[model samples]
Target: MAVEPLPEPLRPAGSGPAWRLRYLSTSWNGHPTVASGTITLPAGTPPAGGWQLVSFGPGFNGTPDRCAASQAGTPPFIRPLSEALLRAGYAVAVTDYEGIGTPGESSVVHGPAEAYAMVDIVRAARRLAPVSRRWAAAGYSLGGHAALWTGSLADGYAPSLRHVGTIAIAPTTQWGLQFAAAGNPAAPVNPAVPYQGRTLPVTHPGGFRAADWFTPAGLDLVDLAGHVCIEQMAAALTGLTMADVFTDPSAAMGEFTALFDPHEVPVRRYPRPVRLAHGTADQLPAVLTEITAGQLAAAGTDVIYTPVSGADHFTVAAAIAPQVVQWLEELFRRP
Candidate 1:
């Protein structure tokens, strides 16, 4: 695990923002491993305490280490969010997650591995810059699940760091719902069409879209999930659902049940301020955040849930980033 300055292309635009790419010596599921990530230092800093670490976990980039967000460089949408945190006097550490851009198995759907990456990257980043003991976790989509889980275990995982709060934006709250919804043609998330001049059976999850959407040969390529980047896989699935591939939802999710169980949705065993947000029009079950947030509050965790009307899962991340940063600043100000 080594720390080095980011390459010229990877660095932030304009003058004055210093950043680095870090390969971390960390663990996943109790085994020693290495991971890669990016750490961006705030510009023109000098608070009474050093810059607060705002640990960010990005959504799916792909299973391959090369697709890691750190390696892809900061995407356009993410640049604004990162700048917001920087202007607020916060340092940002974004974990590529385990196995992405590093040598190791990627268990991204498995909560623990993603959580471990977010927390451990902070431990590695502290060595490279002036970071305060306080830290906050924030993420969107899949990373939302990772950020919350990290906040939940931060106290025990890295006892030296101060756990301030967590922000989960459009998180994947119920994985099972996604699997079951695959075959329900009544409410198709992906575009559906007639097959061979006959109405598609509700049971045929891959009810099928036009040839322009998913050709027969293209269907065979869906198996390439872990081998390529997320964008590619997403493109291949333009008109399909889990049912097209997995006829039996429960049986198909062999290891996933153990990893992303709704029954085991995050609970804040450790006390900290947490904020949860979801878009009203998100493809994810609309009621999920309300239910999950309620569960956290019932479990005695301080929770603030917001539902943004008309926002879809993709747009919700940008919609909520500034709000999350504001929450982090307020949490840091608290005595």
Candidate 2:
């Protein structure tokens, strides 16, 4: 593990005392890789067990190397939450995930890879500051999925760390819903669907060919995705439908399922407490999150599921930040 002061320009505005980190972690395909992140410590002195930690996962920013949170300033969606946690007297560790600021393409929504990066960042953060071994995982959108995966994987993957819980705000849960819509000729496409369309083949382990999946027009957008962040990609692909973005919308199901299914959240019961919150009006849909929370509960996870009546995707994290911080406080206070 390596640590360095985050260059002033690179640190998120108002992040207070922060450090940039590069640490050893595994990629989605199981190859050992170096991952990077930022650790932001509160202004005051530590408490009895040292400052508690929150391994924060930011939502989808983009897939390219330039879009990393530690490289690019933190995105608005998750910045409030991280800052809020810091203000609440905890150190926040935010991973850039599998390849955001590093060499290869980022895994995007690959849960385990992101989870490994998330859990390991806490380990790395501990070495940098006076921190407690007890930590919680939290994230928004795509990150929310990674946070939940961290809950399930943390105990086994990093036995030395005591993972107290997880908080997921509008996490992406059902890939089938999104992919099925993409496969439908008449379905309207969201930026994320096409975004994933461009990424899945490239990130897949078997070295899947992009030509087999995208039409010529889609291929051009795929090329664009490699260079731009989510906002730019979204603008470029705006108004396109599924038919415009895929070669044969129905064709990639086998590979798509193979690539994403195993990475879905609640892959097994979460032994730690979990708090899931989603906006009823989110583009990702609250129904899917509800279903996922149900499965986790049935599987013996100690989960509290809450749906914000009218909030949408972009606002859910800020809307629930106070509640989440309180929950984390209570969680860390426990035996």
Give the candidate number with the greatest TM-score: 2
lDDT of 2 by residue, 57-85 (tens): 88887878788888887767766776788
- Return the lDDT, model 2, position 299: 87
Write the residue-wise lDDT of candidate 1 on 19-113 in tens digits: 55555544544777787888877667557677788888887766666678878877666667777777777888888877777775465555667
Q: Estimate each model's TM-score.
A: 0.83, 0.94
Best-performing candidate as measured by lDDT: 2
The TM-score of candidate 1 is 0.83
lDDT of 2 at 50: 84
